[model samples]
Target: GQQVMQIPQYQHVQEGEDFTTYCNSSTTLSNIQWYKQRPGGHPVFLIQLVKSGEVKKQKRLTFQFGEAKKNSSLHITATQTTDVGTYFCAGPPDSGYSTLTFGKGTMLLVSP
Candidate 1:
């Protein structure tokens, strides 16, 4: 069976600090995708990395893919209230098809 793991079911940060969360899996994956859901909102695709050791960033947020493609991490620099959301890391099963196994996610809360 395939499984994905995410830590820190919740996170709290001030208006201007850094935050990070990690994800790992028991088996190798062809690719990994990230999604973010704002409070009372649906998950929206943020990014996808398919190559081993790939790294990508958007503004203050950075994403990394492990060499084995069995793990990944997301780092956010200079947090803002607008960044508040649940970050989900997901990967497809061996059978594939765009169907994803999602981690429970790390919920971020920011105080003004």
Candidate 2:
């Protein structure tokens, strides 16, 4: 069995500040996926990191994969109220992506 855990279960940041959330897994992962869920909306796929030491960015957001493929992180620079949401990190327990194990999630709360 595999487990995914996220830290700083909740975060509060002022607008224009920066925010980050880290994810760790008990077992090495083949790939990791990130999802964002707004206050009233369902989870939306943010990005996926596959290769070791891989890093990707979307606007002010950056995603990183650990060299060991057992950890990941998401950072938001100049955060905004719109960025408020619960961010989840997920990894497949087996070989396929059909099933995924998700972390408890880090909930980001941004204020003006």
Candidate 3:
């Protein structure tokens, strides 16, 4: 079965630092999507990469698609207390939606 895996399920950072997370899939994916969920909030779309070896950035955050489209990563230049939340990497489902199957996610905790 095709499934995505993420490491360092949890992370803690101080204000004004930096953090990065990685994602991997057992099988190749057609596309991948990254989402963020703030505390007490629903998942929000951040960005999506379709082409192989694609990379995109939003402010201090950077997203990348692996050359094989089977892995992805998110990097935050600098951390902030408001950066506290869970970051998820979702890939196309093996069966339907072709949309994405979200990994458990990497939770970020920022301290003031």
RMSD values, in order shown:
1.2, 1.2, 1.6
Model 3, 4-50: lDDT tens digits are 89987999988888999999998888888999999999999999888
Q: Give each model's whole-structure lDDT.
A: 0.92, 0.93, 0.89
lDDT of 1 by residue, 35-65 (tens): 9999999999999999999999999999999
Model 2 misplaced stretches (Cα beyond 4 Å)? 94-97
Give the Cα-based TM-score of candidate 1 against the true structure: 0.94
Give the 10-residue window scoring lowest on summed lDDT in candidate 2: 91-100
Instruction: Summing lDDT over every window of 10 consecutive residues in candidate 1, give the lowest-scoring window.
Output: 92-101
Q: Which predicted model would earn the best lDDT?
A: 2
The alpha-carbon deviation from the true structure for residue 41 of candidate 3, after best TM-score superposition, in angstroms, is 1.3
How many pairs of residues collide in model 2? Answer: 0
Evaluation by TM-score, superior candidate among 2 and 3: 2
Per-model TM-score versus the true fold: 0.94, 0.95, 0.92
- Between candidates 1 and 2, the lDDT winner: 2
- Backbone clash pairs for candidate 1 read none
